[model samples]
Target chain A: MKSEVNTVNNNISSLAQAKPLASPAVQIDFLNSDDLIKFETKLESSALYPLVSSDIDIFQVNLGKMCNQVCKHCHVDAGPDRKEIMTKETMQLCLDALDSCNISTVDLTGGAPEMNPNFRWFIEELSQRGKHIIVRCNLTIILANNKYHDLPDFFAKHKVEVVSSLPHFSAKRTDSQRGKGVFEKSIEALQMLNAIGYGKADSELRLNLVYNPSGAFLPDDQKGLENEFKRRLKNNFDIDFNELFAITNLPISRFLEYLVDTEKYEDYMQELIDAYNPEAAKGVMCRNTISIGWDGFLYDCDFNQMLDLKVNTASQHIRDFNAEDLHSREIIVNQHCFGCTAGSGSSCGGTTT
Target chain B: MDNSYYDPKDLKKFGNITEWQPKLGEKFFDYYGEVFKEGALTAREKSLIALAVSHAVHCPYCIDAYTSDSLKKGADEEQMMEAIHVAAAIKSGAVLVHGVQMMNKADDITM
Candidate 1:
């Protein structure tokens, strides 16, 4: 039950409340440093300058910013102390929007989406709509409290695709990026998920694990990492998972703070820029995913939502849902966008390529 | 130019060696690439081997490159460390085994 202090809780003057960091302007300024090439310029070279949406097929909803763990590289800066959450009213607005659109997949993220009081209710609503639901579970939350202990069962009941972050299978690596004892709890949570139909060879219940690098490096090949994760987890713990999503940690929020503090910002950004793949760029997730904030604000993607960069369309909120406007509007690109386009490219689902 | 002998940035320019010597550079790169492909040893195993050899040769660039490579290939920290330890043992053993030569020389001189 040991709770790691967050940037807000630590009262580190620069990172206090994470509000200044949350300001899109401030983050944009940081991204626009003199040395780095503009992400837009790179996209332009690849004939992707005005990155537009193909289809708004996925709705990545940030349910809240409250979580039991404070992961070092969390772009959301979500933690237990944060109170911002999507009210049932907002959930209803989202539901109304979903009804109006053809968006078939609903991806729920947060400090832990389950921390939202109306989480189950919102899922129940989405379930009834027959929308494919993906919950970005932190895994530790399932073991964090008594109320959350049955989360696996609840997820299985809804046939929710459970995507949990387990940065590394080893305790030291996982605990370092996440929190101490996080790996142990996550293993227990995975085992629980396995005991049910989730991750079984014969089961439809999809249980995917996410592996972002523990540091500033880009993620390796998805298939290779997945094979390794599968072999190690199966042999070591007898655990089963459907897939491993090798995500690259975007430079923003807490991860931005880390890169700057370690004097690795320029190097990491350069690394991202150098490793930029045009093929990967074409498949960037922002083109297909519209991220909705807790308060109903919309953005191009989850990283954009954290930076407070709303989508360019006039339909800026769930209540003002306009599929046509959203689809036509040019997606926002910043230096942080390099993260998603680097190497294999990263998305909430996994590598785009 | 940087005063130091090594610059991490140079690693990215490694492919550019072909600009000066295209044939040899291309051949070397092709050979290197083909050597690391999945063979009797998994690509993951090759990456670990490369990491250990990177350490043994004390090449900072290779060490940096292969450490990230090994991790990307899903080689965990323990396995990586163990590979390095194997390199360390061989390196030390190479030096220690030469002590037998010293013993032989001393015996010849003294006798």
Candidate 2:
């Protein structure tokens, strides 16, 4: 099985870059073209229209778009070919913004945030500020090269909450969605994290794993899946993690391409519509978390950041950093927003309801 | 509406039987939901049983729903295939066991 990364060597751009889908306007148009009820109307019926932030508690920053693998369902369409990376100046701007706000958590995400040159510096700066740091570490990166081999040790030292994606406990299922050999590497990376008290019972180092469906389906009950994951990982490989976050794959970027190509787009949208839960809608992560793009522009959530939907406020950039304006601004929504509100609801922290 | 006897789309309407026969439909659905919950048998185990039963009954909709249900419940390929084989074994055994009846009839009719 060839790694999906090989596509980069063949000179393939991300789905966004290769087609008219690169334009946010086109994606938004495609989402709205569906005959299903509008997302805002559903919110209105639930009395959640004009959804405004409760408060900004988590500041999620995209470090870059360079990754070791090209996952089939990646909403970012991120890969090795992506050259958009946040510079040190942008990192400084983020730090400055954090200073002005009482936001307690900083979430670092990317194609692979560790791929950024300033990633360590940014983490160090955040650590020094006593902010709760969460790194969305793709486990394979810890073993991708010699330089990254020490990542587990570095993460332990900083007490950075290490949340990694391992789609399934089975190798075939996991690799099918992520890549050919991701499961094995992830297991090895997890063992390394476990060896240094990362996910241990007595350790303060928090390690969590993220699980999404391997195909066009919603994930099973998070608690049940976590139990299954714990049993299988412990019996099969002796790995341990604190919690499992079951996330619904929002239709955007490469995943949107997959849905369109496989002709499951309409059916999937209908599934999401049928599973819509109003309780989940009210707790949608976008209401409490703000997403910052690689270059410092802000959005309602990471999915919005990928689709280029800037936050609806005067302080649309990190440099502006107005908590009051952000708190009162209406969140941007379209058909894709349904993914987050479906069933138990999905957020970076797992089910919102 | 089309020529085919089955439409995958109909699976989504499984809940709508209540519109016409509300009381019985509601009762049946409540029973069905209760039957599949975690009991002495884990939901995962029940899902595998459902997959096997789907095959024995030859219900395409059940086959489709239970297969996804089994996977979602974390039943792997080997476990799923083994469950179907359980159904197959019982189905074949039912046919083979009737050979005793055929033998008895032959013995009674023979000279």
Candidate 3:
């Protein structure tokens, strides 16, 4: 397999493979593809139905795929060239659904959720409804534009929970995965966030840092890694944050290409398989979350959303959302689900165990 | 027969040592496990020390194992590299300090 680094010349052409197929008829195969199906069957033998949604507590919206930076492990293959941005109509649909469903959290994600032109309007609506809003910020977005400089203050004003991905506290590891000068900008963004009492004690403005492994390895214990991050960030830069979330990299999009390019796909898959925990599987995020694409299409979770695997229901769009049917829908699982069940387990918020 | 001195394949078979000699291999494994267990220092600290020593001895296998071990134990790349530098500095000093012995022998023989 060839590396897509050179081919991705800041355009949509780069995402020829990374883009999710329009229809479910296309079969996506990774290294040892059969293992995913067999693993699901193995769970059934143990009387465990691991892939089923219990309730819909989170309404995760992918604002679009227009990001400033093109990360190597980005599952969405989001970059500047991608033109898909959620419009005002879709935002209204999301707001209506949230109002009717009484969802607890409205997770806003994107190439950069803030990149969307209607980001402020969408958040204002969500906040007006008294819904807890979580922005899956990419850190660099805070410093990407001059207009975005006031976002930390904006977030604090709205009492929004910010979950930013900071792969590692160290500049070398972080820049290698993100981009050159990214660590500096991210640190600056973090400092700006801290100044507004985001991560400060007794402050309602909650700030969380996310840690994804730079390579094809599982993250360390969340509590231990959080302590280490807090110590290092504080001792080195006088920066403080709330908590660290360790998310396992699912095999999809550019990460899948990377696994194939490095020839570690089979080994990595086996590692996830051998480390499967039923306890972890029980608490998989898909059980309580519904992911909405930029176009208002619905998915079981973020990974399934990336894979273009729509929910296994006739009402596959948020415009047609029925809480009763969606809550009881069987989660559409595949080999990628193993990434969530391995070892300590992983989710958008943090570790399951 | 495989002619290479170090079969890249054998590294993957480290856990299969008991297949050759079950009794002594098991004993050695037990002792190795005990040596790595936490006492005063943490398993993380021990892994860092192991990573430093692995570089000093120039054993690729040990270096690979300890690098992964150290990362898994929550040691960052910065600390791991620092440990390696410590090993490198000490190894170089050991070689340089031995020049005193060489000088003493030369003086005794020549004088």
Which numbered prediction scores highest in TM-score against the true structure?
Answer: 2
Estimate the TM-score for candidate 2.
0.93
Residues B1-106, model 1: lDDT tens digits? 7799999989988999999999999999999999998889889899999999999999999999998888777788899999999999999999999999999999
Q: lDDT tens digits, residues B29-68, model 3?
A: 8999998887787677888999999999988888888887
- List, for all models, the DockQ compared with the true complex: 0.60, 0.60, 0.46
RMSD of 2: 2.9
The positional error of residue A323 in candidate 2, measured at the CA in angstroms, is: 2.3
Error of 3 at A148 (Å): 1.2
The i-RMS of candidate 3 is 1.9
Q: Which pairs in model 1 have colliding backbones? A: none
Ranking by lDDT: 2, 1, 3
Q: After superposition, how far is residue A34 of candidate 1 from its true place, in Å?
A: 1.9
DockQ of 2: 0.60
In model 3, where do residues sit more than 4 Å from their true spots? A1-13, A16-27, A31-37, B20-43, B72-76, B96-111
Question: lDDT scores for all predictions?
Answer: 0.87, 0.89, 0.83
TM-score ranking, high to low: 2, 1, 3
| Residue B8 displacement in candidate 1 (angstroms) | 4.2
TM-score of chain B of each: 0.98, 0.97, 0.85
lDDT of 2: 0.89
Alpha carbon lDDT at A49, candidate 1? 87
